[model samples]
Target chain A: MSAVERIPILKIGDVLLASIQVDLQDRDVLALQEDLAEKITATGAHGVVLDISAVDIVDSFIGRMFATIAATSRLFDAHTVVVGMRPAVAITLVELGLTLGEVRTALDLEKGLAILAELGERAPR
Target chain B: MTAAREDIPIAADEDVVRVRQIVRSFAQRAKLSLVDQTKLVTATSELARNTLTYGGGGAAVVELLGEGRRQGVRASFQDSGPGIPDTALALTDGWTSGRGMGLGLSGARRLVDEFDLDTEVGRGTTVTVVKWSR
Candidate 1:
């Protein structure tokens, strides 16, 4: 097994942004989920923006990771919006029968942050 | 007809990523479109993980092929681990013997142009899939 890699999580206001710029291994996926959960708890962020523009492909494992991350974030009242999914990746996921349940998605980083911002406004202060 | 071939060992999580990279490159070399390449790589990723986890580690053989005017990428995953006892149930969607979403075989078949499964109760299993350029 190779060393687990961490996806850098950046904070913009109360929203945490995790941009996945590398091809993810299974271990890396698990590490990201753990890291995101911890960050949400520590920072008390209201929203998360997962930017996957650089992700070239996704299987069932990675697809489920999105749902898992969103589900985890909800526990801390954080909304996750996955962004920048490539068209090819989107088509493949649909054909593979993965709906990415419970994971909200957007077209790009700008739109994703917008959604998060809107959700943040709607949340109870 | 095979134009080029590479064998990748699926022993760990990293190997699964390697398998995806190899398949992606081979798909490109075969002149597959971006969507086709993505589909093949994604399907291979699922199969590679199954080889490492359920199959208890294995090897993947990827091939670039040309038949007349058709160019295609083919990959075969083979493992010496205990073979699946119930292939039918194994292929059923949402049915998992482990932690997977049970889309490895069935889902892979959906993404490719061709898929074949050869398995025995205790003799190990081999899954071969192909994606042809359009």
Candidate 2:
């Protein structure tokens, strides 16, 4: 069996970036959620950008995981923005009636960081 | 193009990921477009999840095929658990019997060129889908 591949969450300034490039397993999903939550507390980040451009597919569980990450980050006073979703993934999400509730999305990482920056400015310090 | 067939076990979420990988490998071998590959892989993942979660475990068979000048891949899911009580309702958007968002059947059908479902209460369920290369 191949070794486990973990999604690395890198911090740039006050924003955390997590790029998903693998077809994640169940444990991997749980690991990401746990790791992101821990990183938020450890880094004191004010924003997070998850780049899923390499993620070609997402089911309800995966979609729910994304929403959970965003919701969890909000608890730490950090904003989360998802970026780089392919067109086909969008279509599947819509067809499944998954809105990714309250999780912001952008076309790419640059725009995602920009949105987070904008939100950070609007947030009451 | 009916060249190869593979049966993958689906007893857990890990198996679901495995199914997607199998789909991806076949899609690449068939020279499907990236978009098409993503669609089929997504569809197969959903189906595999349904088999593992709702069906109490099952298997998916990936097959490569050819008709005239058309080439494609087909994934068929089979399970020995309780069958769906209402397949039509199950296929509806946002309708789920368990915890899912009900995208397994409907969304999968949309992503592929052909889809077929077979189930018998107290017997089992089977779902088949095909995506032709464009």
| Each model's total of backbone clashes | 0, 0
* Candidates' RMSD to native: 1.6, 2.3
lDDT (Cα atoms) of all candidates against the true structure: 0.90, 0.87
Report chain A TM-scores, every model: 0.96, 0.95
Measured by lDDT, the strongest candidate is 1
* TM-score per candidate: 0.97, 0.89
Model 1, B25-113: lDDT tens digits are 89989999999999999989988888889889999999988999989999999999899898888888888877668888899999999
Q: What would you estimate as the lDDT of candidate 2?
A: 0.87
lDDT score for residue A99 of model 1: 89
What is the number of residue pairs that collide in model 1?
A: 0
Candidate 2, after superposition: displacement of residue A103 in Å?
1.9
Residue pairs whose backbone atoms clash in candidate 2: none
